[model samples]
Target chain A: MDLLYQIFVDPFVQMGTAPDLLVQTLWEGLVSGVLYALIALGFVLIFKASGVFNFAQGIMVVFAALTLVGLYEKGVPAFLALALTIVVMLGLAVLVERLMLRPLVNQPDIVLFMATFGLTYVLIGLGEIIFGGDPKVMIADQLYLPRGAIDVNMLGGFVSLQKIDIAAAIIASLMVAGLAVVFQKTRIGRALRAVADSHKAALSVGISLEQIWVVVWFAAGIVALATGIMWGARSNVSFALEIVSLKALPVLILGGLTSIPGAIVGGIIIGVGEKLGEFYWGPLLGSGIESWLAYVIALIFLLFRPQGLFGERIIERI
Target chain B: MFYREAGQYKTSYAADQAIFPVLQDRLGLIAILIVAFVVIPLTGNEFLLQAVMIPFLVFTLATIGLNLLTGYTGLLSLGTGAFMGVGAYACYKLATIFPQVNLLVWVVASGFFAAGVGVLFGLPSLRIKGFYLAVATLAAQFFLSWCFIRIPWLYNYNISASIEVPTRTLFGIPVTGPTAAPVTRYLVVLSIVVVMTWLASNLVHGRIGRMWMAVRDMDIAAELIGIKLYRTKLLAFAVSSFYCGVAGAMLAFLWLGAAESESFNINQSFLVLFMVIIGGLGSLTGSFFGALFIWGLPIVLRNAPGAFGLSITAATVEHITFMVVGALIVFFLIVEPNGLARLWQIGKQKLRVWPFPY
Candidate 1:
């Protein structure tokens, strides 16, 4: 008992003097949580408007990031390169609406979902071929994010906060707030809600399905681009980010596909939970628990609250 | 016609209930079996049996498995690859622990492990439906895949985290691992696929299959008709997973002789899903036909450029393959949403009334 206490409990007791490592992990987790929320935002945008679970949203994050970095390397200025990338995402949105969604307007949800999976491969191959299958720097310094950390004293311990994390949190919050206003207060938001309510009725009311699709897709594109940038800054920007982007699947499950607020709350819950669990309790399981902890949490969450935190309760009547 | 079924009718209930009641179908099946069992072994080279035939057979089994759960039961799953991984790991553990057990016994029993996990994953289906259910199953995919990577004891803590297939044999014939003869391995895989396909077919044509279809078409209607949706759906998951488990074990043991988590990623799940969709939803023939086209097309794409006068790089071929396959999926959905099997049935119907207007 004395040996165990000195070996395990001593770290927490010593934390009163120095907690930089603990705070750093939490900071890292927050930045990643922001990126995850960004990817989940893209998924929620498409699902809310189209009722299609866009599995390709992860690839879209990679595609947009790769496009931005790939073009910047080709001599486009960083900001101009970012703009060009947005244009490319918009083009992708337009192309998808015209070529894929329009043709299968009333197809089964599963069919549409599968089509997005096909879209995923299309983007994967095309993005690889065009951008080259290599990880690149996200030009964090050029964007003036920062490279240092801030230390604050808490509970007789000093906690370190990275500038990149502060930037990510601020930027993500602004984007989420902006998106919330657009979804709630704008004319386009009303149209989107109407379309979401009933595709046939919205079409009957002269709301162009094509136009709404283009708008929502473009919105998803922006979300993807922002996600790519923030996530790129954390790790090197690369195609390997696809796996991390896929983490958003469990996040979406926790958040619910149809609720924007659910995404934010779910993102934080998973983010903080995974981070804390990995730091404190991961050693109990030999570490690497962070990798699948969110999923475990979501699985248990599904058992009790399958509707997600803010999602509409699905009730199927005979 | 020589293929006609005349003078071959069954007079007894037992005979009529045979797996292949039609004489021509039975004969055709026997001829196929003979070719696979005899001629291929006698004439074919090692490469054909190992690379193409073995993997194709295993994936065909998995496609059949997915077809049962997703196509017939209308329960969407994105965890097919993970389920297959469960089977492979389970088989590996079993074979290691039971050194004296026959290879075939271990393979068959490995499926029970996958089925057990599949049923646990399938539990959410009783309460969820549609897109929600797909999400739920994806949890199964990640959770199981996580188990393989994290649970060191499950994989015996290989430093590189990849399981190396151990050499094992049956009847003095090397059937798996590096030393295995290609022909012996092919026969082993072929035997499993043949018997399992028969089992799958029998199940699909029986009362259980009808109940699954009823649940798929309309769960409320199925319940109203006195079918217990919960028990039936779980059974579909278990049976489907058993087939996938055996397929996964075959893939690891017979085909690759080694595999990493990469082999069973979500991409693999998507490939099988596409096969089932392109093949057909509610048809056993669709599973076989879909597996052949989806799995075989890539090989043909990789090689066809070489046969032609033009030289195409492998990268370009991969790119072109994606574009072509993607277009075909959309085309299939647009032209005949019921898939390739429906198209085949239509062709058969057309052949019956050919050369004259009704």
Candidate 2:
């Protein structure tokens, strides 16, 4: 009975007593969820267009951040460095499409997936060599990202919110809205949807698979850049961020791999769930349940809905 | 010409179904075994035995473990490191509790513990497939790893939170612990690896392996053929984790001597998976090739600059090694998506038809 009370009753009581802390935890989760959603958006963009689950998405986030910070450290202005990073990402997309994707056309999805693992290694090596191993500041001040915190007094206490987190939430929503428009309205969008449906049919209709791959990969790279800046603002820009980006995987599974909106909703759900689990129940489990809690949540959800909340139902003819 | 098999004839069903049907292959196996058992151990220095060969053989076992599931069973798992940790920790606890039992018994038996954990995590496999399943396995990896750190009981309440292997003897010969000679440890690990590999070969070529392959090729079709999908997949997970568990136990007992949880992290899982895919999925022999390439290349690259009289920082060499390994993975995949096993097959084919285009 004591164990049951500890498991179920105590955490809720604690939350009720410290509602301010609860609000703070929720805010933190929202900020992290927005970041996770951004990373998952990059993954969804590439997976939908090419049917390739890009395992390097996490590393790409780190690499993009490192490049921007490295350039800024070398005395390039922030905006110019951002432009140069975008150009570099575009060049990377072209190179990948030509060198990797072209040769690997029609291979099994797993094979392509493994190829991305290779891409991750190469990017890690290159990034480390060029930028060095030391962590760098994200140059958020020069970029004019907001700093400090807003303290809200409510429920007999205070909740402090970081202005940067608010900006991140707003930016993420705008980007999603913009992406929705582009995906729904543009010619390239139709071409991407077509390629996503059937490669042969897309080709039959004169859609260039190679071009679409480049565009989508480039677009994912941009998303990765924005994610890097936001995440790096929160912490130091380093290879360690690569592991954190893997948090996006739970979000991807929860949201449905191919659904943009699913990524957003999944990200928030995992984010809030992770924070709540860590805050209320972590001590009972000896702490540090946050790492796997998201994955466990996704796994349980998968037992009931294998296709995910937004995923098309898998129809196995064979 | 000497490799020709035209005159060889099998008079019995057992002879016909032997692992190496070709006379040349049989001879090759014998030669390799002789070198492994006699020649290399006799001449190899301490570094070669301990650093290069022992870890190579250990990783080969782990790769074979993962190959059984991902390659043969068609389930892509990312939780191999956690499964391996279960084995190592289980062996540690069992050995401490029963000091009189042969450590070797506990080592092999530890695989059952890992197998249990693997099956528990693998329950979701029946509902999910592909990347979704892979993510599900990540839950196993992270949760188990967290448990390793958080549960002090698993480490026997050690202040350092590491498993220290105590000296254990077989036939009164020291085979483990800090006091054990490198050659003794090597021999122990090699023997276990060779026996496990042989068993794996037989298993892969038999009925259970075929069920795994059928499922891997197409689960729905496999299920239609009256094969129980859940049972077959869980069996694969259990068997795969069993091999990994034994490998993990040996990795700690015979190789590292003392190991922290850091030794069996996600990177270890990725390293074994790399070996499996780069070596060739679904081929036991390819596991060896994969282990050799992935493990040996770094050692070679690290030394190449020194041998060439070029002075470079150790960190730079490490970075270059990563770049080279990454590039080679891409190159090999582009050249032969089937992997190094296919290359070996192609080479054998060309050798069989030497001096002829066809």
Best candidate (score: TM-score): 2
Error of 2 at B188 (Å): 0.8
- Mind giving the per-residue lDDT tens digits that candidate 1 earns over A132-249? 6778899787767787888887755677787877887888899889989998999999889999889999999888989999999999999998888888888888878888877787
lDDT string, candidate 2, A1-318, tens digits? 999999999999999989999999998888899999999999999999999999899999999999998888898999999999999999999999998999999999989999999999999999989999998889999999999999988989999999999999999999999999989999999899999999999999999999999999999999999999999999989999999878999999899999999999999999998999999998898878998999999998889999887887888897
lDDT for model 1, please: 0.84
TM value for model 1: 0.91
How high is each candidate's TM-score?
0.91, 0.99
**lDDT winner among the candidates?**
2
DockQ values of all predictions: 0.37, 0.91
Stretches off by above 4 angstroms in model 2 are none
Angstrom error of the Cα, residue A183, model 2: value is 0.8
In candidate 2, which residue pairs get closer than 3 Å at backbone N, Cα or C atoms, i.e. clash?
A: none
Reference interface contacts recovered per candidate? 0.26, 0.89
